[model samples]
Target: MKRKILAAVFLTVTATSAFTGTDLILAAEKTEETAVQKPDMEGIDTENTKIGISIYQFEDTFMTLYRTELVRYLTEELGFKEENILIEDGKNDQDRQTEQVEGFIEDQADVMILNLVHASAAPQITELCSEEGIPVVYINRQPDSLEMERWEQEGIQAAYIGADARQSGIFQGEEIAVTENQGDINGDGEVSYIMIQGEPENIDTQYRTAYSVKALEEAGVETRELLAQTGDWSQSQGQKIMEEALDEFGNDIEVVFCNNDAMALGALEAIREADRTVGEDIYLTGVDALEEAVQSVVDGEFTGTVFNDYFSQSYGAAELAVKFLKGEETEPVTLIDYIKVTQENAEEILELVNS
Candidate 1:
């Protein structure tokens, strides 16, 4: 249909965020360093090597910032023209994402990166792309291990580039666990808490929800869960959940664990509205050390957050895609690190992000 020399390339940014610091960082490293063996295809390359990307939703605040950084990364590497970069918003719809994938294949893109609306559907997508010889790089929402295994077994040129979500959870939990009160507010040995989760289906949500509480208990505090429900990563949902939880549990709720900064901010708002003071009456924590969240940690309104380092993750994903296009053997998976953001390093991290 469309005149082409080489084939398609797909680069996915799962950045609903994806980095790091701290001695707590854990990475599953895959080493790939070799010479580029240029393909003999007619399409050697061009300045406008079409790059297609599909993100879960544009409304995600962290992903917005992440995609901005990703664009800078790809532009630097590909000199990609504005028109050559096509970004489709799945808007949390699976069918919309499926349609977008079909369109990308029809257009015969050079590369694509996907942040899937449903990571479980990755196998079907991968099979479809492999048939057309398109390499996929999945970012934020990671597919199942079995799906990844299939890709590896079939030698499908697909790679998953993101940080370990479990690390973020562990960091968030450990941050709260180390707090002065240790999440035990009422002089009772129990750490009573509410969990404001992101999407229930997302692995990040599951890990953060479980690990935050696990960390508290591991640090020798007896934990009592008052409530744990999905907030779907929305500020309003988080606020509503916190308000209801406060009303229900009253002074018994010692800590609030939001899976991300948006929910943490929402919980903070509810705490202030209810006239309960943070760092005094209750404690709160979240993942994604967004600017406001970091500032809150500094201001003593929040316990802390896990710094989701978008810069390094996006850079690695984009860098790998370029290597793949140049016919270089690239790692099938790239794992980055996550940092715990607290008053100790909040200022430094804020400056780092701003810089």
Candidate 2:
């Protein structure tokens, strides 16, 4: 089994690394402020304010934590009535999500939190809410910048709140780039990787898929594309696709890159079943430091993953929503930074996820 001699490099997290690109955006200590400091809604009146949450897909691993934390913040921290917080699953369908937004409008929701199923439809969705005079706070998935600008021109109150996805991709790539052999599984002085993507229309998927490879190449490692396909961010889909790739590429498959941890978990199952050991004969990587995926990293089952920081992201969304509800000035786009997760801090990451 090949192992990374540089594995200990990141034992103590730092602002920079040997593989960091000059263009890469630096992560800030705002994560400190994001994790702690409960919101002070002392003067805010949420007595009858209705907060309608529209999730892109409830089955998604990361979104589940997001939605849970969002509700927890609203009720527990902000002292909002549980009955006033209405959440609906978009089920990954744009039309269904549109209908949900329409319902929020007709129901006269005080504010709406959106995780757009299709970011391309942000204009339509935003227009729907705008027509009804409802303020929107987008989370996780960001709408097009043009759409946002249009809203600003129309004097609409809307903003996108989430971590920069390009950063997540960079972190994902850095994990493999810093790994031993540069993730070169075949020992041929090159890396060959299979990519499991989420929905192609999703901006997060596009950035993660692109920047991950860009980061690898920037590290002076050559990569051969084995197979790159969408798993729709589903574990079953990930397992099915991995099974097919194994049959097609066999041992030539050196690495697996999943856009999110759910798909990575699925690929891990298939890889273990096929007797291809990760961090050994083969390697795998993903985002969203999910508990199972983080534990796998600790157990040396995965190369690494990026910690998506659901706690901070969820809180940031709620904070923006409160500002919207209170008619306060909020930034047009608030970007949070992501943390790279490896075996070095897997236990700490596991605590964050499990807690």
Candidate 3:
């Protein structure tokens, strides 16, 4: 085992130490503050503190950016050494993730941040880490509420750091609900749309799919699902699904809701190839205001997207890991809110991402 004493006695006072579970749950207020640069954790011997990060897949556009930010924050911002950070790609396989985590524990990593291949595996992973006294920070894919409850009850050094998917879902739906015709293209008195979903088991997929429609209904827009299929969070899958749906539903498919920007981009390609014009005959929305997606919104090609705020999420996760390593208390769940990106503010969002 390796450790280092704090260079400044007060350096151990972490920002998150003052936050309670309830306070952290209301994360929107803390977003700007959390995203600001902080003192590097050089006082704590970052060179000796091993950090383990496991991503579901590097192929995911959002996760790729997320993990990149996470590593950059840990190393450049927080002063962790390159050799001390270990990242593994699960290749979107549960068994592969399990194996990598087991290896991390075997190597006695100081902390682990996981974007699980399967959120259902949280209980097992938490148990393994807790037994070894290694703190775990779960991100992106959220585990069930009951699993979080277990962590609180047991006082485990485990926390979940991510955005509330429902918020993102509501943003996705409201984007279309506020449209000139309220997404009721062709004056059919109903908004018939296609849902391009990610993984079926992902909570983000479930909420984004359900709440986007719920939001439309809440805004008095009658909605009918023309087609819904799992795109598996792939660009090709999204394009294929959209092409098939367009073939069957044709002009009746008024709006398309994709769970993330990658799928939306693919869906956009399919729509253009089908000779359908967005904002003229159809509308589209997605989450994760990726640079391209935000640009599309600015170009009036995409209806809108929900900004996932990887900067805050990744920074928050790294901050929590530092807190745990310092023996500080952390909220079992820390939720960062999502932001809606529309054509009006898409340029600003694109600037933010680039900056």
**Residue 298 miss distance in model 1 (angstroms):** 1.3
- Candidate 1 ranges with C-alpha deviation above 4 Å: 1-46
lDDT of each: 0.76, 0.80, 0.84
Per-residue alpha-carbon lDDT of candidate 1 for residues 113-231, written as tens digits (9 for 90 to 100): 88898898798888778888888889988888888877777778889987778877777778777877787878787888889999988988988888777777778888888899889
- Judging by lDDT against the true structure, name the best candidate: 3
Question: Arrange candidates by lDDT, highest first: which order?
Answer: 3, 2, 1
In the range 217-276, model 2's lDDT, one tens digit per residue, is 999999899899999999999999999999899899988999999999999999989999
Backbone atom clashes (below 3 Å) for every candidate? 15, 1, 0
Report the candidate with higher lDDT, 1 versus 3. Answer: 3
- The predicted structure with the larger TM-score, 2 or 3, is 3
Q: Which ten residues in a row have the lowest lDDT in candidate 3?
A: 1-10
Q: How far is candidate 1 from the true structure (C-alpha RMSD, Å)?
A: 7.4
The digit string of per-residue lDDT tens for model 3 on 101-211 reads 999998879999999999999999999899999999999999999999988898999999888888888888888988899999899799998999999999999999999
| TM-score of each prediction | 0.87, 0.89, 0.90
Question: Where does candidate 2 clash, by residue pair?
Answer: 4-180
**Model 2 spans > 4 angstroms off:** 1-36, 40-43
lDDT of 2 at 73: 74
